[model samples]
Target: MLTNTVTMTTVEIAELTGKAHKNVLADARKVIEMIGGLKSQPSSLGYSEATYTNKQNKEHPMLVLDKHLTFTLITGYDTGLRHNVVGRWIELEQVANPAFAAQAITETLNELQARVNAMAPAYDEHVRKGRTVGYSWREACRLADIDHPDKLLAVLVSLGRARKTTQGHTQLHPDYERDGFIKTLKPSNLVVSKNGGHLFKITSKGLTEWLKAKAEEMNTAVAFAGVDRWGRPIK
Candidate 1:
């Protein structure tokens, strides 16, 4: 399982946090200095200085921080804003590890197809209506063996894959939406769309690609790989 070393630019950090680039650059340098002096091998240092072209095509200096360094740099920020950076890092990781992510999605799709096969009659009805790409969140939790939709939503929010609104409705996290794991839709009877807000539908890929892994990691009974829609034991 090879993974590329992912890095985030201080400029991007500025954009993410709504801060000035120069301020982010200064903060990054301070983080680098506080950690240690410049090393001969920047790769081992977790941060490196680079230049970016400005509006006038003039090169301006910036710092590129690795994952660990990025988290350290954002430690002082508000939790909500810090989440912005965290989401950005997740995107970078997916790009840096596309093979692993793609393989996961491919495998999840297979398992979902198996489930679809088991529910052929119902599935074919959805296929006929051309609505087979995703499952209503309620249906998603049911298929995953979650006892309650809120319980599943809580788990997803805890894992940073979903967000709970002040009104108590659950929305798919931006990171998951960006990665095509979940989609937001207008309120409908097919979904548990509360408070007249958008409903969340977990894409089939999301059910296994993202939710399954996190659920298993947390010891929650999500969709079991190699099992049909009925959650038959997969020994």
Candidate 2:
């Protein structure tokens, strides 16, 4: 198990080595005295006094050791105990290193990205040509990677591609009807809150059409701005 260097108390050390707390404190003081010569300099071994609450709910002074000081203290123990302590200290060192953590995170992200890249072709084909019979507004927005669902919903409603009732019920676009897409019945099992609005399901045809329109709009904007798709100024 991993332990924090700064918070590794003498009480914990005693527990780990199956020694008395007082004996561990004595050992720590001896180590401190040896480093600083006669006068007690606890900081010489990165040792500090902290308070720990015992099982009886009483707080008592305890010695804390940083990584370097911890190894020094643990080295005085028997062979088997020394091995265990060294292993834990090694784990603590790895966890505390910023470079190690960053590299670990980078490697994890690279693996995740590699998996996503491997699946991208299939995912793109599904998005472009697959049939989505009944998907809610949120689901549709997620699938399309659209950030503003309300804006798209408003546009759809205004273009007569969708309808909304005063009670917040929505109707599918007629274009989807022409494209052989079907809508599922509004589920009755859900409890409708007073502020809740019904999200109408959309077909894959509707989703594909919306994406195409959005892309065309973006292209038109880019052309008007005299910039390429990558936002570079056109020569």
Candidate 3:
């Protein structure tokens, strides 16, 4: 499995190599000492002391090593054991990269196109003739293939189209509103006072012109953002 940490513990190394944790710890210490004591040339040794809790809830000292130190420490091991460690290291490194994740999201979305089409019937015609209108915010999001309002807000923000307030209501950017892509709704009893009693919705032009472009853009943005450390991608 992929791990966020760049370093590996001697306990995990022992598991991978089918050795005792105590033995792995001894080997790690020897490598650390050969390079220099932990206090000297620490960077080259790439090790740090940590602790692990046992079944009895007692903490015991352990060593964590970065990739360089890990491989150096394992150099004396047989070929199969070294391969196991190398395989696990590759898995950990992949956690930091998002190219594969983006590709996966793209493929998933493509596979769901048929279902999206069935749910959003006539959406294309409405956009093509420039007559799209009368959709509530939720309906608009559904037609755009965005799974949630929050996800839609993320896509809009990435496209420089909208923003959300600290109070958690999303509002279109002034430039977009002025361009006739979106309009503010009159305050109603259902509107919350915290948002100044106003709600925003896409205009006819927005549904036809703006949303058409944004739907595709949302695909790319969702794929990239899905793997971003900040948020998950829109399904």
Candidate 4:
């Protein structure tokens, strides 16, 4: 039997991440694509998580984890990211210096996550409530500074970073036209519109999905996916 095609909308991922979905998903997806393709697991975190709060003692890191970077790590793990060094070229000093290997991997991971967040869809909902003329792949690529915004945007939307307008020219938004691509990304459900051509709100279900995205981070301290929401080890 022929399989039916599937597509994801920003509303779906916003629903997935439990945040205001809409244009945000598009923005996130664009930035992520601009950064480059996705990765499942990265080897490292280049920069340290900054102390986020400016208050006498604020919570969270100052250098917020770039959403795109998180997506890179997730996609990278699924794909294979080999170390650049040729085994023969590895030196004795490199072996002795643990920091060398650690730093390289960290940089890779940080890059991945940083890009994902940058491209995540976070559009102006009040402006574009429903669909309009639709976005051209080339135009999007240009705006986002991505070489292949078409492909990258599709990935981000499918993965829940951003979404596409369902009622537009599928040709412009290739994600709607692609069959297996959507199936592979497998978005959970639903898309929405607040006004003209912007905004996607996360559904109640998306809240849980965004929560699961927490699992996407690369492990810097030897723990796989490291630390549950409660700060407890996965064991």
Candidate 5:
């Protein structure tokens, strides 16, 4: 297949820069408004409508940006993020010119894939040896910044967001379940050891979900302060 230039949406920008999607959208709107005022209208240097399928498997409208607009939006970010965005743009540019960059791109991708494939057998061996490899419960809690693992585990179990082994050990629910919050751990990647019991492996996806959930919880607490669930004032 012939390679083409890759465009990014505001959602992707937010994820890359660790900004809220809404905030990125707001910034993009401001840019659009500013460009609208210019006499020499750079019609091609603005966002376009796009759709992104979120973790919920629901598609939503979003704004996509070409290289020009992506750089424009990145300018409003902090120095550190600005540098990272520039680096990412460089990567995009290289891939966008595959005719000139084919050899370098192919070698880089092959090396990365080879490394990943090389680890597969070790992961399989760990499973066969009955060793549960991956992030442990404590590691997950640390990643999520949750101080109370027991409480969180109970909540996850109650909500069917977690699984219990035959030995009554809690594991991150598999991703096969559409409604599951975390999809990082797979059955092949998990093992039940006689000594360690059942181990739940945490994944980057699970960590991201955990952080998002925590953020939502904090937002809810702030929004619902001094108000009852029925929206009545707590007087």
Candidate 6:
């Protein structure tokens, strides 16, 4: 359900958020690698131990602030975590009288939408008989309680979501990436693509088969991805 929609360029976030470029860069370092639109911190956390390196990178020095911000973003998306205390800090950030800081939580929710858009699901085999592809990996992992790399594949394979891991090939059985969907290239799998990007969808056969498999294991719940027989989630 979380998605990242309103993406700002790093420069744009710095200007709109009323933060120094260096400060923004420091705050958004880890996330920059993950998504396209980036936001900068509105202001400094003013920690005494925070140091600014004059090096070309010019990283943020305040570990406390850095930790706080990173955790804020992570916990926001992490559904498994029990605590929702990030709500309190985000509330506090709203009152700090900065440009984008006031909209921190809302902006994050928008980012979640954008991220979900980026995820753009495709059908894969659900290991069930008579089914093609149906469920997205995000829903599967959560339902199966198999977030670990080995276990994820195990469930996927058991549900016919994937084939046997090829020890010889790397991309076919890659390490777990905590970003979006698990990609597939089996001819029978779903096929997805954007207006002007590489191919990124699976086959209808893959979707049906996979959904049948998934239903056998997890019959009652609905996938938030909400993909239907036509292989599209309800927008």
TM per candidate comes to 0.41, 0.37, 0.39, 0.19, 0.38, 0.21
After superposition, which runs of candidate 4 have C-alpha atoms over 4 Å from their true positions?
Answer: 1-122, 125-131, 143-235
Write candidate 4's Cα lDDT for 143-174 as tens digits.
Answer: 33344434443555555545654653122123
Best by lDDT: 1
Winner on lDDT between 3 and 6 is: 3
> Model 4 misses residue 135 by how many Å?
1.5
> Model 1: clashing residue pairs?
none
Q: What lDDT score is found at residue 36 in candidate 6?
A: 20
lDDT of 3 at 229: 75
What's the CA error at residue 168 for candidate 5, in Å? Answer: 82
Clashing pairs in 5: none
Give the runs in model 5 whose Cα sits over 4 Å from its true position: 1-6, 37-43, 99-235
Q: What does candidate 1 score on TM?
A: 0.41
User: In order, what lDDT does every prediction score?
Assistant: 0.65, 0.58, 0.64, 0.33, 0.57, 0.36
lDDT of 1 at 154: 60
- The order by descending TM-score is 1, 3, 5, 2, 6, 4
lDDT of 5 by residue, 147-220 (tens): 55555666666667666777566565565224333333333443445313335554444444444346446334
**Candidate 2 clash total?**
0
1-235: candidate 3 lDDT, tens digit per residue: 3335578999899999999999999888855643444454565558888999978999988898997788776665665676677667655665654443646545544443333334333434544333433455665555555555566667777777776566556677787678787666544535435433325766656654566446656666666766747665445
Give the better candidate number (1 or 2) by TM-score: 1
Q: Which ten residues in a row have the lowest lDDT in candidate 4?
A: 80-89
Error of 1 at 125 (Å): 59
lDDT-superior candidate, 1 or 5:
1
lDDT string for model 2 (79-120, tens) is: 556555544544455666544464655564455345444554
The Cα error of candidate 3 at residue 231, in Å, is: 67
